[model samples]
Target: MSSPVLKPAAELASTNRTRHPNESADYRRARQALLVEEIELRRQIERVAELRRALPEGGEVTKAYVFEGERGQAAFAELFGDRQTLVVYSYMFGAQREQPCPMCTSFMSTWEAKLPDIEQRVAFAFVARSPIARLIAAKKARGWTRHKIYSDTAGDYTRDYVSAVDADMPGYSVFTKRGGRIRHFWSGEMGMDTADPGQDPRGAPDMDPLWTILDTTPEGRGNDWYPKLGY
Candidate 1:
């Protein structure tokens, strides 16, 4: 069946804006033009998400990897709990680093509050290279109560999925189970090579909503500013 015709987003965006009493004609025109681009950007975001959802089946997860959790060690498959899908965020807090990556911590703080809603669909967990006890301590220090935290103490999962060289890098991977077999689904692969000029290599749909919210403000994410472990 053919899709129904709809009004162009730009045209729709142009029609409903209310003018402010103190704004000048120039400001009004500029705002209207920006609105058109904003509408187009929204359309592009949806298009990208559609493509992501339609991706083909990924490789089978044949190796039985295990990780350390607060309740002791657990098999990789067990991380999914009762859910069919699992999202693993490989945080950059390895044995070599004294502190966790502040950027990763910042992004995760947002997820803490969103766990209840997110777990209703897919299971989510944060995996790091630190020992299970250390990871738990950091969770407590961060005041996060909802996220499922784990440790790749042996670095097997980290080397296999995040970095073969065991580099201290943040990574995100998703997996799903079907017919009693687990398979890779998707991952945030965007990095320094895919980054735009003068911008940090970041995955689009930017996993962290912090940057997204900041982008909407008058002063966008600055070139030098980055989240620190402590203020």
Candidate 2:
């Protein structure tokens, strides 16, 4: 089946013309500037993706880590199931924290909605530093029963992927497997940033497409927004 269609903002703008007169020239200019910056940013990101695709594969990982699934006790390989590629999001939910990271929760909410489409290309799993029991409880509380959840309580896998560093480092990493060999494809700590820590003090730019799309709206992602447990 074809991938789900995502309508671009420009297309929508062209088709729908209903601009408010009170919208000042300055406001229009700023909005146009933002749209131009977004287009250039997308081109630059695509270039970076090309470079990443050309790089040599990273090291392998086969350590056995435990996880809690719909069927109870599950292993790392079992989480991967039959898929060739596995994309793991290292969620920042330590064993002591009362709740999972809110930002991470937001991203997972989007992922949960697209689980079926994601499963078509590669398998997806959420790995947290919290214990299996804690992870399961959080999942149940969030009502995320369809997507897979796992625990990296020992910090072995999270450390390997560089997703867990001290208590603040949060990121995403993708890996692929063939036979007994596993190779890292891509690892991005900066979700919407331009550079890493030392390169720029500002710390990478936030270029998440979801945020960009939301920026085009009137409320602009809104102030009091949180992912609900259910739709």
Candidate 3:
């Protein structure tokens, strides 16, 4: 049987379900217009995801990147842990910094609760420049139990995949070990350099749901506000 064709998002959005009684006609008209754009935005998100999935196979990784984790020293290949795909989040916790980047920490906090579900399909690990003990201490302090945290004590992985100068930066990278060969799949390359005017550089389909939720409010993520380490 042939698949059924779907109506355009704009057409579907035109049939908006409900409206606030207190709202003015001007508000409803503007909201309907916004709904159309929101529908287009949703479509754009799917298109981008499709393009990401269609990307060509990335370069193979030959280096035996070792990391210090709860299991002591482990090679990069061990990170996959039976999964074909591995996701490594390079945290901005370099040796010089006493604490981790608040932005990175905020994003990490969201993953803590969803790690189990996410790990079902792919291996996920967070790497930092601090020692294993320090990483553990922070993890304990933050009450992060699900994430398999690690320390890149040697700085080899950070320098190669994260920052050339080993600068404190947050990065997200995915690797795939298919057909008995491991290769770099993708990474969040956007940063300050790619940010638009009055906007912070962030990955599409943002990893953190905090921003997504705030975006739905009237006061969208403002320029002055940012996630903090503590209240």
User: Which candidate leads the pack in TM-score?
Assistant: 1
Best-performing candidate as measured by lDDT: 3
Q: Model 1: which ten-residue window has the lowest total lDDT?
A: 1-10
Candidate 1: lDDT of 231? 88
* Worst-scoring 10-residue span by lDDT in model 2: 198-207
TM-scores for all predictions = 0.96, 0.69, 0.95
Q: With candidate 1 superimposed using the best TM-score fit, by how many Å does residue 105's alpha carbon deviate from the native? A: 0.7
Which sections of candidate 3 miss by over 4 Å? 1-6
- Model-by-model lDDT, in order? 0.89, 0.69, 0.90
Local error of candidate 1 at residue 66 (angstroms): 0.4
Tell me which residue pairs clash in candidate 1: none
Score candidate 2 by lDDT.
0.69
Against the true structure, candidate 3 reaches a TM-score of 0.95
Clashes of each: 0, 7, 0
Ordered from best to worst lDDT, the candidate numbers read 3, 1, 2
Per-residue lDDT for 104 in model 1? 91
Q: In model 3, which range of ten residues has the least summed lDDT?
A: 1-10
Tens digits of per-residue lDDT for model 3, 142-221: 99999899999999999989999999988899999998899999998888988888898887888789999999998998
By TM-score, is 2 or 3 better?
A: 3
